[model samples]
Target: MHPASAWLANESAHIEDEADEHDLHAFQAIRRMDEILVNNFMVFQDVVEEGCYDLVVGDEAWDVDYFLHENPELKRFAFAWMTDFVGWVPMPDGGEHEVALTADYNAEMIEQRARYGRVRDRSIFVGSPEDVVDLPFGPGLPGIREWTEANFDFAGYVTGFVPPTQQEREQVRRRLGYGEDDLLCVVTVGGSGVGGPLLHRVLDAVPAARRLVPGLRFLVVTGPRIDPAGLPRRRGVSYRGYLPELYRQLAACDLAVVQGGLTTCMELAAADRPFLYVPLRHHFEQNVHVRHRLERYGAGRCVDYEEACDPDALAVAMAKELHREEHAIPVETDGAQRAGEMLAELI
Candidate 1:
């Protein structure tokens, strides 16, 4: 069972139970293994024991060092990212640190991630594009290792990656009601509920955008965190609530209008889709980590959505990006295999 299974069951048993049942075969097969690694979740920190697994791999979170120190029997590693609450991300043992640099990669942010990683002890530093880690560790995010190398001062090296297959892209496109002659644009919230209301300001332009550009259709993907109902909608707008198939949906689109989440940006880049991204205002990750890197990648530019919410401005923005080139820097897409190997060497 996943670390969060019990809690999900308690909070929403129908969804939770269905999930368990769907993955029951895999769960039974895993139990037959000699060892297993469950994803690290902050909510389960206390409940999970030191001996819960042989290794624990996680993204930036609180008290990582404390958890490892308390459980000396376990091996742990962290992939660093830009966030408001980075705290101290320390990898157990004599391991080096890997940073998945975001769009706004710079001298300051490099030092920031390095500073956080080296709080308790000095360690080797390796950098990959943001896609590698959330555009995440491996093909979970493609083109990240390359993104980091091009813009940042650090060496780009991450061991895992996964790119979507053509078949997968077709499936997602069909699922999103993509038409042969339609210009598909994907709008996303990046799994954070924080900027839902603000995003509507951008979506409000879609009606006019459609009027300006023929054969254009919009898919407003609110992500898992935001409720689609709360967002503004109309008869023709494609408001997809939460489609877990990220790379495919992105690949199917002609352009993307998105929030400043590293994974969303990287996926759009990997899929060769142009977008006008809006990093959340006053957010370190969006404002600093993602804002500055837009021109660097040619994927899209950042918009101060609040100030740029006039539907005309939004329509022009979308029209301008329709012909924009994506992938300012070429991204190497061989992360999944590399990540698996890297994790194997960690212990």
Candidate 2:
């Protein structure tokens, strides 16, 4: 792993907890991007020089395409996985100039790539145009194809447990020692330590929520970055370290409480589970892009971090959402296959 990975993870926690420091954090993060790109370019260059590969694929890493473009003599086909839209990001200051500022930054990057002669032979959006935040350049940006939600299968991309069957759900619950009558609420913070605050708040509301729903149980999965021992222990709530197949557990649960990250939110949506997502303040991607997609799918309920900090309010919301029936539109499960076929054509 690059040396900056650990620092970036630590910075993510700091930014998530201290919303006031967002601007400073953003500056620091942007400064580190060049270093990361350079490191990636060096490593990739070494590997490519050692082998003869037909195609280069990048999974949300722009550096891969950058390296390939820079070494155009290699004459290799490049494929890009654009997991999210790139333009129209909101500035932290929320000033009137934010739109122009973001647009200019995006335009600069596009211009740089254009100068390099369109290295990306094929690129696909992981989601439909509806899932995209309205881009300044619009969806028809050259050399990019979009996978409609109905055709963009997320089964292999996101998690193996796409939508658990009734039997699979029962087996997962049994393995977790949950009773059939118990209403299970799985709380997760994705892979970042920044979710510590949200996890603590959820733990605080457990007592009140459980009182309202007698059979309610909480399963808090402190991901790899978080130490489960650091959290408070309480009845009706079970704390566990990272689980390999967390989505399976999530799919089987009665409800889910998660951070505003797209992966976790979309996992719950695919499982058709009722969930409450708390997006970090000033997180433009989470608050704007992910929120729009979820709204389009009629998925998770959005609760602001401040409202969630109030234990009483969070408890009431949790209880209310737990029993609420969701009729979310089904996400397509064949995206990986479609993507494979597209890449196969290039080979």
Question: Largest lDDT belongs to which candidate?
Answer: 2
Displacement of the residue 16 alpha carbon in candidate 1, Å: 23
Candidate 2 residue-wise lDDT, 110-142, digit = tens: 665567656666666666656665544323332
lDDT of 1 by residue, 75-191 (tens): 233332212121111112213321322222233334443445433221212234442232322222334344344433332323233556667667767776675667888777665
lDDT of 1: 0.52
Candidate 2 residue runs with Cα over 4 Å from true position: 1-32, 67-77, 135-161
TM-scores, all candidates, are 0.63, 0.84
| Residue 281 displacement (Å), model 2 | 1.6
Which regions of candidate 1 are displaced past 4 Å? 3-52, 66-171, 292-295
